[model samples]
Target: MASFVIEGGHRLQGEIHPQGAKNEALQILCAVLLTPEKVTISNIPNIIDVNKLIFILGELGVKVHKIDESTYTFQADDIDLDYLESEKFKKDGSSLRGSIMIVGPLLARFGRGYIPRPGGDKIGRRRLDTHFEGFISLGAKFRYNKEERFYGVEAEQLHGTDMLLDEASVTGTANIIMAAVLAKGTTRIYNAACEPYIQQLSKMINSMGGNISGVGSNLLIIEGVESLGGCEHRVLPDMIEIGSWIGMAAMTKSELTIKDVSWNDLGQIPRVFQKLGINLERKGDDIYIPSQEEYEVQNYIDGSILTVADAPWPGFTPDLLSIVLVIATQAKGSVLIHQKMFESRLFFVDKLIDMGAKVILCDPHRATIIGLNHQSNLKATTMVSPDIRAGISLLIAALSAEGTSTIHNIEQIDRGYQNIVERLQAVGAKIKRVD
Candidate 1:
């Protein structure tokens, strides 16, 4: 396994451009199976998760070619759906939570799909019931084998219907959209997930001749077509990465500028960071973060200690809650970090507490952080990453610490971040990837 050795207390001051959205790119890549023509995706992040999905696509007999460093051309004209049932395919496919996305497109285009249990952060119990429910509503029959932990779906005809998901799960909405894009009738999905990722998938489907409306909203209407032709689309900028950079710049008291951020796509993230006393100055497509000694953590609307929580789209992303929690430890005032999405995400507070930050873990989901206020410097130590976001948050914390820090389980970080150490090094961060 590889680890990151970060020499802390170095200010990072340079321009950084985030890669394409990892979350968005995963679903879009799977959607390529809906067409036989070449589906060209630009600005795609070259990350571990994306690469893993490409490997899975290749195993399924899809011809995937890299056009450039950040562009990919996928042609599934000769896709062999039988490979999806292979044990190696199931094993490799189960390594990512995004593998479930292939079910919809596979079932839509081939009338049957098989998937093993998908893997990701053990943050919380994310159920696939919503996704299966949507598939059943679209006329798919499902069978689950507990011994193998595999899910199978088959249907003669996937006719669209009016369906309402119990939870606006991101992958659930994506699965249904991919399935419905080639179904026979109109499908109305109310309470759908409208995250930028889902909207990007919808745009890609529309470009391929699927009729989709009400993108970026809770309600989605899809008019099924006989088939979809391949079209080219670019992945959107990673807002979460941009947000992570914002938190990193604030924590290290560095003057940094983030380039090419889609200003219009950032929903309430800037305001949420402002509540933590971090200010962002927008100059066209760039976001400027000036160096600051300290930021005051404000109270909530009720005048009590402020509690920042995560919700679905139109809300702060759950992925950034860990970053915010780490940043709050350096703020001037106290605040509550509410991680409603994941039960075990707050467990890392014990590591931060060992570094001398005053934190009270209320439970598995909440932590109260009392800032160090630039008066204290965290003593460097060795730690292990538990998940992708937690790993990056630990990296940011390590960079802001007083001495050198070693973070193990860097594979967790690489799963989502593309060439993270290389990118950070370019911006003056003294980090080395060691095995």
Candidate 2:
């Protein structure tokens, strides 16, 4: 295990580039299995989860070649179908949540897919029913082995049909889209997730000879093709990382410029930070955040306290709520953060409270933060990170605290952010990764 030892009260300054979108990379990487042609991808983030998925592909007999530091070409021409039933696959597939996505493409190409019980952040109940139901709706047989705790889907041939998802689950939608693109006839999906990641996946599939429409909406149309071909695709910048940097700048009173953030695809992220009274300037495609002594929260027009909640795309992302909640600790006013998607994500507020911030955990999903207004700095303390988003949020808090802080279990942060210590060090942050 590794930990980050951070000395507080240092102002970070300079320009930092956001890595490629982690979510999009997961879906796009798995999409390579839909075709035997060579698919080249650029701007792939060098992170643990992504690297694990790429390694899993190699274990499945996919040819993976490194073109450069952030580029790779994948060819799934000779897949090892028998490996899916191996004990090694069960251990590997259970390591990351993204491994579940391989099932869709495998089923489409080889008529069968198998995966062990997937594992990921323990934020809330992340169910796989939506994924299996979508596959079953497409004429696939779904089976679960209770003793082994494994899921398998098989079909002689998949024929497209109309599917109205119970919820617009992002991974669920991506899995179904991959399966539908190779089915016979047409498939229409309603209440589908339309996040930029999903839109990019659809675009990448189209580039590879698949037909899909309604790129940025809840309704999607896919006309199954006989096969897919190779294509090159580039991932968008990571919005979650952008939001985290914005929060870090505000908390530490730093001047930082996040470079080449896909402004068109950020949805409600910028405005959400603005609601917390963070100053942001858009210089072309970049976001420049000026150093701040303090930022105040804005109340509602009707005289109610401001409430920041997470919803589907076009709304505030749940991933950024942790950063928002942490930044709110230093703001001049109070705000309510509602994490509707995951019930237990707000429990980290207890740690912030221990650091002298006023926070009331209303429940598992809601937290009311009364900003300290910089009257006193947060006192440094030792703590453990529960998950990726929460870990980064705590690191931001530590950077703005009065004394040095040690955060254990920083592997969660590394799973999402690439070279975090090195990146922050270049921008004047006094942080080190200790093993």
Candidate 3:
């Protein structure tokens, strides 16, 4: 465990570059198992979760070559299926939620996929029903060991079939798509998750000779192929991290320019911040945010309080609602944050409240935040980060508070963010990590 000691009430100015998408990297790494040829991937984020998955791949006997700090080439020409049954795998695979993704590629190529129930943030109920159900729909036999909390799927021969997912789960959609890509027939997946990560996976698979259509849409059509070959792919910059940087700039009133943001891929994130009265200017794929003394949150056109909620793609991402809630605490007007996806994600608002932000926790799924208008600065406090998104939100709050703030359990932050202390220090933020 580690803590972040921050000296607040300081303005920072500089350029920041977001790391490659963590969610995308998970799927892309697993896709390598579908091919025996070399697959090169660039812009890979060096974070705990992604690194853990890469280690698991290496343990499974994939030949990993480091091209540079941010790029790697993987060759899955030989795999040790026995590793899936090893005690070491039970421990390693269960530690990262992203490890669940390897199941799809394994089930497609080796006829068996096994993983101890994976773990990650303690946000809420993250069910694997969508994944197992989709596998079952694709003619895979499902098995679970209740005592060990382990799950497995097997298929002698996969035959694709059309399926309507119960929910548009991103990982679930990705897993099914990977498994379906190698099946014997065409698989049409409706109500699929079309997040940028999923679209990127589909595109990468297409370049590797997988026939996939209806990209960037909720309905995906995949015609099974015999085998996949290798192709080079570059991951997009993490959108969630980009949103957090935008929120930090507003809260600290810093003139920050984020480089290579891939503006069109940001969907509703920029507009969501704009609705909160944060100004964002695009200069040749870079996002330039000028310092503002105070920004006002916008109410509805009908003269009501604005409510921000999360939905599937083309909608505001649920991962950023915590940052949005924290940003609203300093705005001129009030806003309601409805976290429809996860029930426990809003629990960190208590830490915000203790720091002098006026917030009303409306049950487990919603909260109401009244703007402080910067008339009074938040008093410094000590808190513990419960999850990755909330951890970053608290870090933003700490940066804008009156005095020094201490945040413990920063391993959650490290799970998603890459070199956060160094990156912030480069941007003139007085932050340090206490190991």
* Runs of candidate 3 exceeding 4 Å displacement: none
lDDT of each: 0.91, 0.95, 0.96
Q: Residue by residue across 1-435, what tens digits does model 1's lDDT show?
A: 999999999999999998899999999999999988899999988889889899999989889898899988999999887788788977998998899999999889989988999999878889899999999999999999899999999998999899989999999999999999899999999999999999999998998999999999999999999999989999989998999999999989999999999989989888888999997899999999999989988787778988899999998899999999999999999989888877888888778887778889999988999998878977788999999998898889999999999999989999888988889999999999999
Model 1 alpha-carbon drift over 4 Å, by segment = none
lDDT of 3 by residue, 156-259 (tens): 98999999999999999999999999999999999999999999999999999999999999999999999999999999999999999999999999999999
Give the true-structure RMSD of model 2. Answer: 0.6
Please estimate how well model 1 matches the true structure, expressed as its whole-model Cα lDDT.
0.91
If both were scored by lDDT, which would come out higher, candidate 1 or candidate 2?
2
Per-residue lDDT tens digits for candidate 2, residues 1-435, read: 999999998999999999999999999999999999999999999999999999999999999999998999999999999999999999999999999999999999899999999998989999999999999999999999999899999999999999999999999999999999999999999999999999999999999999999989999999999999999999999999999999999999999999999999999999989989999999999999999899999999997999999999988899999999999999999999989999989988888998888999999989999999888789999989999999999999999998999999999999999999999999999999899
Q: Order the candidates by lDDT, highest first — what do you get?
A: 3, 2, 1
Instruction: List clashing residue pairs in candidate 3.
Output: none
| List of clashing residue pairs for candidate 1 | none
The true-versus-predicted C-alpha distance at residue 257 of model 3, in Å, is: 0.3
Q: Model 2, 72: alpha-carbon shift in Å?
A: 0.4
* Alpha carbon lDDT at 4, candidate 3: 98
